[model samples]
Target: MSLIVQKFGGSSLANMQRVFNVARIVTQTYNQGHSVVVVVSAQGDTTDELLSKAYEINEEPSKREMDVLLSSGEQISMALLAMAIEKLGYHVVSLTGRQAGILTNSRYGSARIKSIETERLFKELDAKNIVIVAGFQGWNKYDDITTLGRGGSDTTAVALAASLHADVCEIYTDVDGVFTADPRIVGNPSKLRDISYDEMLELASLGANVLHNRSVEMAKKYGVKLVVRSSLNDSEGTVVKEVGSVEKMYVRGVARDNDIARIAVIGIEDKPGMAFKLFSLLARERISIDVILQSIGRDDTNDISFTVKKADLQKSLGVIRENLGMLNAKEVKYSENYSKVSVVGAGMVNNPGVASMMFEALYDADINIHMITTSEMKISVLVDVEKAERAVNAIHDKFKLGEINS
Candidate 1:
């Protein structure tokens, strides 16, 4: 029998009826004579509610304790899902991340999985038991409960699939499949039939939110297959594999990230090691940067602008400000009014006019581009957060991405 690893997001298990709905989806796959393993996220708003409760008690709760608290959301989902499967006359068992033998580093709220001991998973699967795993959590080296940050459930599922060598890992969400643009932002965006791992990775990192970027990275590294589909329907989902369709689609999808803040180091010395010293300080603090632009040196000084997630704004500002004199920088300036909009596709590597076309779209839409960055597979532009949605629709329409045969 083929082995399948399935993951359900919070929306799929939001209520009792939805939980049972997920259970039936699992059992139906089992009835087809395949070995099934399921991973699940917290129910609707459970994680948020828990975070609110924690903040109410302590504005700055201990990271270890927060991990412990957040991890419970997935555990509740696993148990309730297991109970539903049992009621459907299926042999089922629930296991937490630790119980399932997932080991991670001691990073508390953003731990990276070190390794997974698959002996327990194999034994349970061999016994014909449907294994339900609590996603987004694992035990660290210090024996402390740790979480894998937001959207970590997707990483958990892919990691499990790689460890078990499952035939396929299906990620069930609220949408039917990956769309050219977020449906809420762009009307009538087309759904991709399939996408390459690299394309999906760029989209995820650029903020498509259909899948996690780390999961896509792992899938690419281990050659694991992924399918993203809706849990509430039987639609054919989007397939993510090593190579996508052979069609010459220059732009496959448009994505917008509103969670970014721009930081500019103003009046920095235009010397050789200044930029290096400035960024190295932020790196030491584990802050990630994106879409960097360096202004031409004038008057022996230059301005460097870059973007970071909004969550890291304060930390990043603190790091830069504290080291301003050391790096020969004058001042640190930041703004939370900017957002990133990107278009991703493998074809962009060999295509010309992609950037100009994207710019043209923005120009037509009366939007201003602040910063730009490009790679072989993607192009990202920063614009006003308030105009981000219009920018996305403009870019998507410029490429005619919504057309079925485009």
Candidate 2:
């Protein structure tokens, strides 16, 4: 019998009926005599509601306390799911992240998992019990509850599957599988049958929300098998592994992220270490920058523009402004009206004209491109948020991504 690790997202367990739906999915696997371990996120909107409640009490709650508050969401899910499995006359045990031996660094709301002690997991499995562990939370060295950032449950599940050396890690969500483009934005985008870890990682980091990027990183590191499918259906889902089946396809998917804001630091002295001094300050503040563009030095000055998540825009500005004199920069300009759209594929490594094709599509759509960046597997462009949807559809059709499965 295979040791299967299954994870259900918040949408899959939104209510009583849905909870039972997930229960049956787990029990069916258990009935087949395979050892089962289940991981779950909070019920739908519970995390948001809890956050609202916390903010109502305090505008800026302590990160430590926020971790304590947010981790409760998954606890509710695990217990209810355990009770549902019990109602089905099956043996099940529910454990919180701490009880299940998930250890993480003390970063509070965005803690990084350190290690997972799998003795308890194996002990429970040895007793023939279906183990249900709370996702998105673990305890730090101080014994305080810590949460992984949003969508961290996917990371939790994959980490467990790696530590346990399970046969396969199945991530069940609302959608059938990973698609070439978000079906909501690009009509009838093709769902991919299989994707490489590198391509999936790019799509996830670029804001395709089907799977968390950290989970893909861990899966690749440990060589764990992964499948993403809809919990509500029995269709075969997308498989993520080292290599994709469609080797000749130059592009695999298109993704858009609307949470980014661009910052421009203008007129820095055209000298060595200027870029390093400017970015090192932001790095110390843990503000991640993306899609950076540096202009050629002119008149003894150069300008650098970069993007960061909207949430970090203010903090990033604060750090730069506080140290403006130290970095010898002239002025800081910022905007929140932009979005990033990207295309990812392993086949892009040996491909040419991919960028030109993308730019041509945007040009035809009359969408203005603000900045551009490229890697071996992906290309990203920043554009007005208002035209982001048109940009996505234009590129999707330009590449005929919808016909991927045909």
Q: Stretches of candidate 1 above 4 Å error?
A: none
TM-scores for all candidates: the values are 0.98, 0.98
| Model 2 Cα lDDT, one tens digit per residue, 115-215 | 99999999999999999999999999999999999778999999999999899999999999999999888896999989999899999999999998999
lDDT of 1 by residue, 219-272 (tens): 999999999999999999999999987365768999999999999999898889
Stretch of 10 with least lDDT, candidate 1: 242-251
What C-alpha lDDT, on a 0 to 100 scale, does residue 345 get in candidate 1?
A: 88
Q: After superposition, how far is residue 222 of candidate 1 from its true place, in Å?
A: 0.5
Q: Could you tell me how far off, in angstroms, the CA of residue 57 lies in candidate 2 after the best superposition?
A: 1.2
Deviation from native of the Cα of residue 237 in model 2, angstroms: 0.5
- How far is each candidate from the true structure, as Cα RMSD in Å? 1.2, 1.1
Candidate 2: which stretches are off by over 4 Å?
A: none
lDDT of each: 0.94, 0.94
